[model samples]
Target: MTAAILLQLVLNGLAMGIIYSLPALGISLIWNASGLFNFAQGDLLTLGGYVMLSLFGKAGLPYIPSFIMTVAVMGIIGYALSQAYFYPMLEHRVNPQIILIGTVAFSVFIRNLVLVIWGTTPQTYKNPFGSSVLQIGELYLMPHVIWIVAIVAVLLITLQYFLRGTMVGTAMRAVAQRPTASYLMGIRNDRMIALTFMLSTAIAAVSGVLISPIIPLTPSMGGIIAVKAMAAVLIGGLGSFSGALLGGVAVGIAETLFAAFVSSTYRDIFIFGVLVLFLLFRPGGIFRASVSEKV
Candidate 1:
């Protein structure tokens, strides 16, 4: 490939990587805190995007207010879901496997409900910035792509700081490490788990809104992206923030390069194949830590 083409591909990959990282981070946070694999995450993201589109595009609201409104609504929805379903399941001592199945069912219900409400037709959110491309040397970039990358960077840095610097964030980390001990220490375990879900879903919703300018909104879009994001989480490592970032970039680049050089038809299959290999060989994930069990 020519240098220009390669540069463009890298930029495209980076933009896509930023978009994918949101969901990967969401998955990691929820899994580490609650030990529940939330299958409904992607659908929640889709719901957020549609909610934004409906407010801004259809109802003629300004972009900034619409964005804020969407995030708030989705966060509340996530919190409600945790309180309604997962909280009761935890209280009843439900198996983790069953919880996973319940999440999957929730995902299906949300997706179908969206289909019923919005119909099977696809919709697009009007880009606040008109379709404009910027060229730097040999690389061509879009305004939306820059916005996505910047947003991802800001969020990642802010979240990392919050988790490391704040009391609540420290408490969350403690809960993830040992829930029973955390509760013994007077941390409200349920509230922390619910907060994790709310924060993660809000992040996912923001991602959907940012990427809506680039991709069309459909009820089923969440399913495919969620799978890719899960693969990213595994490839990066389960609980590592840096792992999620690296994994997302790797997947995005791999997909783009493969589609450019090989066949687009096999792009997804190839990515998933890589994920399986990672799981089979390095089950601890790309970034592994050794923990000693106390007697």
Candidate 2:
């Protein structure tokens, strides 16, 4: 590829990667803490996007406040879902495999619920950034793309700090590593698990808000994006934060380059095929070693 074309591709990749990474982070956090793969995560993202779209796009609320409201409301929904459904199941000592099925059912239920409530029609939200594009040298970018990158960076940094630098962060890490040990050490395991769900949902909601302006609002959007996020998490190494970020960027670049050079329709197929290869040969992911213990 030419230099200009390469630069543009990398930029496109980074923008898409940022969007993809947000949900991956959520998945990693939940998996690490609870040992449950939440299939409903993507639907949660869709719910967040539609909630914001409805409040701001349909209700004519101001952007800044509406955005805050959307995040807060989605966060609560995430926490509530965990508390109402996931946590009770865990407490009752239900089978992990069955919980996985429940999550899948939950995802389907949420998507169909959206369809029934909003009808089959797709909805569009007005972009707060408008149709502005930025140019640097031979590279061109959209204002929303810039927002996506910046927001992703901020969220990643914040999560890193939260996991590494704070008391709650330390407790969370301890719980992830050894829940029973953490409980014996006076860390509330149940609370930590709940917090994990809330945080995961919050991150998903943020991703939805950031990308909604660009992609439009639709019920089915989350499923595909969720798959991409899952690929990112698995490729990066399950339960590894840095791995998720790196994996997301890698997948984004791969997708963009493939679409630019190869066929866009085959991009996902090619990317997922590579993922299968990785699973077969390096299942522990790029950034982590295979471990017998949880996470």
Candidate 3:
């Protein structure tokens, strides 16, 4: 590949990877906080996109307001799911596998529900920023790509600050690292976990809205993105935010270069091939998660 095309592919992949990292980070958050993998996280993305489509596309709301509404709506849905289903089971010490199955069922329910309401045709919104390109030196970038990178950078910085600087963020981190201890310390574990659900889905909603501009809106799209994001999470190390970020960028760059150099149709095959190698050789990913159990 020529240097210029290679640079373009890298930039494109970086943006794509950053988007995938949003949901991957969510998965890691919930996993650390509750150890329950919400398979429906991706469907929440689909739900977010459709919600924004209705608000911004059809209802003529301002883009910023529509985006906020989409994230808030998704957060409420996630909080509801946790309070109504996941938390009760957690209180009773339900089987993790069964809880996992619950997530899968929820995933299927969402996909079908979206299908019934929005139908099968792919949809998209008008570009709020219009079609424009920005060139820096020899590299060219789209406005949306620049927006994605900037947003993700801001998000990561804010998250780092929130988790490290604020009491509530500290409590959430405590719960993630040590539920029993955090509960003993008057952390109100239920609320923390519920808040985690809200945060997770909110992040997913952001992913949905950011990606919607890049791709068509479809119920099935979330599943594909979910799989790829999950791969990102796994490759990045389960609970490390930096790991999730790195893993996603790695996957994105690898897949994009593979598509350009090898085969566009088999990009997924190449991605998974890389995943299998990681799974076999580096199962703990770039960073290993630490878990402590108190009896």
Candidate 3 per-residue C-alpha lDDT over 50-165 given as tens digits, one digit per residue, 9 for 90 to 100: 99999999999999989899989999998988899989999899888899999999999999999999899999989886677888878777888888898879888998898889
lDDT of 1 by residue, 1-295 (tens): 6899897887788787777778888888887887777888888888988899889989999998999999999999888888888877886888888999998998899899889888788899678866888888777778887778887888888999888999999999899889899999999988888888888999999988987877899999999888888888889887778887788888888898888899899999999999999988886567862212210
All predictions: root-mean-square deviation over Cα?
2.3, 1.6, 1.9
Model 2 lDDT per residue over 92-206, tens place: 9898889999999989998998888776677887788777778888877788887788767877788889999999999998988888899999998877888899999988888
Cα deviation of 238 in candidate 1 (Å)?
Answer: 1.1
Task: For each candidate in the order shown, give its overall lDDT on alpha carbons.
Answer: 0.84, 0.86, 0.87
Q: Where is model 1 poorest over a 10-residue stretch in terms of lDDT?
A: 286-295
Which ranges in model 3 have alpha carbons more than 4 Å from their true place?
290-295
Score residue 203 of candidate 1 by CA lDDT: 91
The alpha-carbon deviation from the true structure for residue 160 of candidate 2, after best TM-score superposition, in angstroms, is 1.4
Q: Model 2: C-alpha RMSD to truth?
A: 1.6
* TM-score of every model versus the real structure: 0.95, 0.95, 0.96
Whole-model alpha-carbon lDDT for candidate 3: 0.87
Determine which window of 10 residues in candidate 3 has minimal summed lDDT: 286-295
